[model samples]
Target: MTFGGLPTRWEPTGESRGVALVAPGRAYSPAAPLLEFSRRALLQHGFTVQQLWWDSTTRGEDEEPEQWVRRHVEAAHAEEEADHVLVVGKSLGTRAASYAAERGLDAIWLTPLLVDPVLAEGIAANAGRQLLVGGLVDELWDSAIARELSDNGCDVLEIADADHSMGTDDAVRTAEIHLEVARAVEAFLSQI
Candidate 1:
């Protein structure tokens, strides 16, 4: 299908609980491990998931990232189930945090850019049930903001010795963190 003139892949289930928009970080496609995990988890929870293909080639240097993302999300939401949208954004895609806040949608932010004041504030202001997972060592990951978001009822997972890629020296530990994130997403979806 097409969304906002960009390509899209729709994975809809028969008995969906809601809609889930899997926003991929610029580095990867919706098939990226992080986004794939989120899509699978949402599918397991009976959500109709739409994986958007963000056309980086069309992005203008002077364009506002928030508006760019919001336009696409809004376009997709118009056709599918959207009463309970779960916006899952990672890395650069985290710029869409404010879009979620504006729409009052639940979200799962992986390695979100807490360094961006506007993005961070959007994550904080969004009243939807949110799962914010970031590594303590990642430059973009701010422990203080994570703590604040946690204090404000957002489920925050601060991984020690991990970096922006959710990786550490130990491969086993990294795998465990990955599982933990998926489980947290499942739990959050259940609650939502």
Candidate 2:
């Protein structure tokens, strides 16, 4: 499907309780493990998932990275008719945090760039519930900032020894980490 002139993959459930707008990281497509499992979790919870794809090559010369991300996310969100909306983003995709905050939408941010002042402030300003997941080894993640956001009422999951991809050297442990994230997502969905 196409939303806001961008190619998107829409998965509709029989009886959806809400709509999940999934924004992928620059390198991480919707098919990536973290996003793919998260989409599955949303589907299990009765949400119609609309997964967006970004083409950086199409970005305008004068547009900043954050502006480009916000443009696409806003476009997709504008097309949603559901009252309950959830924004699930990762890495570059997490740039949409401000949009979610302004719209008072719930969100799940995976490996968010906690270093970006604008994004950090946006997450802190979110009016609805939020779940923030990040690996301790990720350079973009700041433990202090994550804790601060947690204190502001956002649920946080910090994985030990995991990298930006939420993976460790051991394949078994990486798989377990993935499962753990999925379970966390499920639990969060249950609450809100």
Candidate 3:
């Protein structure tokens, strides 16, 4: 499926209170465990979800990576009619942080690339409530940065021993981690 010239999967809920624009990572799709559960949580909270799909192949020849991502995110956002908007992004999808900040839209960034100055700055600039989920073991995640953002009032959830996928090598523990994240997402939505 495609919306606003980009591949998309839309799930509309009854009497939706808002819209959640889900931006997937470089490899993770909306159907992945983390994003899928997050999507379900959003639906349970009365949000209509629109998941954007893209990859390196989707980028134009002359376009910068960040610009490509922002363009797609903004285009999807423009198509929404809801006054309330929430952006749910994972890893590379966190590139939408700046766009969300500019719009003052609420957001949930999973495994955000905190090492990138631009991305970190964008997350900091967001005026709306934001939840940042990252693992201590993930190279892209910086504990100091997350703490700094938390100090600035953004909600932060740092899972120890979990990797970039927010999972450990132990299957059972990984599943439990997923449950923990799902619960966190639910709690965050409740506050919003």
Per lDDT, the best of the predicted structures is: 2
Cα lDDT tens digits, model 3, 1-192, are 774565455565578899999998988887899999998999899998899877657677998767888998899988989999999999989998999999999999999999998999999999999999999999999999999999998999999988999999999999988998999999999999
- TM-score of every candidate relative to the true structure: 0.89, 0.94, 0.93
Sort by lDDT, top down from the best:
2, 3, 1
Model 1 Cα lDDT, one tens digit per residue, 1-192: 766765555555676678888777777677776777888888888888888777766878887877787777677677775567788888877777888888878899999989889899999999888999899889999999889899998998888877887877888988887887788788887887
lDDT of each: 0.82, 0.91, 0.90
Candidate 1 weakest lDDT stretch, 10 residues: 3-12
Error of 2 at 152 (Å): 0.8
For all candidates, what are the clash counts? 0, 0, 0
Evaluate model 1: give its lDDT: 0.82
RMSD of 2: 2.5
| Best TM-score among the predictions, by candidate number | 2
Cα lDDT, model 3, residue 22 = 93
**TM-score head-to-head 2 vs 3, winner:** 2
lDDT of 2 by residue, 35-134 (tens): 9899889988889899988766787899987889899889988888899999999899999999999999999999999999999999999999999999
- Between candidates 2 and 3, the one scoring higher on lDDT is 2
